[model samples]
Target: MLEDLKARNPHIAIYPVSDARFSKYGKVLDGFDFNQCLDIMQTRPIPEEGNCYVASDAELMGTDVAGELSRRFYAGMPVQIGYCNGNSSKLNALEYHKGSEVDVAVTDLVLLLSDIRNISHNELSSESVEAFFLPANTACELYATTLHFAPCKTSSDGYKSIIVLPAGTNAGLDSIPAPKCEEDYLLWMQNKWLIAHAESIPASKGAFVGITGDNIEINY
Candidate 1:
């Protein structure tokens, strides 16, 4: 599958999530059992088109590993459990939170990632992006500095991934505040800062247009 992905997307680098190249962005998580969580995720519905993200879900949080995740992975910090299920295949946008995000892939999927450090004057080039493949049932953590968005599908059946984050990370803000710095303009939701491609849906919704170059689409 990885070789097929590489052959089809020859213009960019693609690696398995276990590769050393993934270390800079985040680490492959271990110790916690994600079976129960994966089971719950299997029941979540994928949208007929595009993607659907739930910031938090009670059932997902009720899993036994949720407490272990909070106590161990998050160091006692309050966290939310949710899922992103979709058929998306484009690099529509990139977003980062102030804390690490844990993802447990319920199915095989591809993630388009970049480094926040590469941003200059609030803009990032699509050329800086790299792709990583996450196989079914694998879990990994994306650091606060890792720029990411919805997972791209690796097959026509679409994809499902369990998302863990500090509570309220992607919830809508009650009020928009005035920008205090250039980065503030990229704030799209509570604790979520984003840079959208000019052609993305987020761009049309007024997200800061900061991605420069082609809005990359993965050919399945």
Candidate 2:
């Protein structure tokens, strides 16, 4: 199965988190008890298709892990703790925040990423994205410049990941601000600027669909 996934997506290179190439953008977080956050995921059910992502749920926000994330990553700025879980096979879209985001893999998963610079004219070319494999119980800080979204499962079972970010990230906006420029159209959620492939659910819901090319999906 793993061999088939690689054969199907020859363009995507999957690297381990320890690879120096990965360190160019983010580092593995150390000294944190990731299980406390992983345990929170078990309290709820994961969606069977695609992913279930909550930006800032109260239960996740209340954990000691949340406080540590805020103190260590945000310089004491309030942070929100959420999770994205379930079976995802596609890189349907990419969204980024003004602040760094920390993702702890409760189960082994795959992350699809693209450099922020590749986003141009409000569009992100699908050709530029890369895939990275994250092992369970490991954590990493994705810089503000990294473009990402939900995790893709590594196997048939699905995945669980704890997402931590600046408070209010991915929250719904009270009202849509009229776009002053091309960039403004990407602001689909509070603190979230997105670019979605035409086939993604976000695009179907009328998010400023700005991606071009195939909505890359992993075979496994």
Best candidate according to TM-score: 1
Top-scoring candidate (lDDT): 1
- How do the predictions measure up, each by TM-score? 0.98, 0.92
Candidate 2 error regions (>4 Å): 1-9
Clashing pairs in 1: none
> lDDT, candidate 2, residue 17?
75
Poorly placed runs, candidate 1 (over 4 Å):
none
Cα RMSDs, all models: 0.8, 1.9
- Model 2 C-alpha lDDT per residue in residues 1-220, reported as the tens digit of each score: 3445566667687777788878756779996776767777888677777678887878888778778877877889998888888898899999989988999988888888887899888888988887888888889989988999888887888988988888888888998899999889998889999999989888889887888888988766
Report the backbone clash tally of model 1.
0
lDDT (10s digit) by residue, model 1, range 1-220: 8899889998778899989999999998888998988888778988899899998999999999889999998999999999999999999999999999999889889989999999999999999999999999999999999999999998899999999999889999987799999999999999999999999999999999999999999988
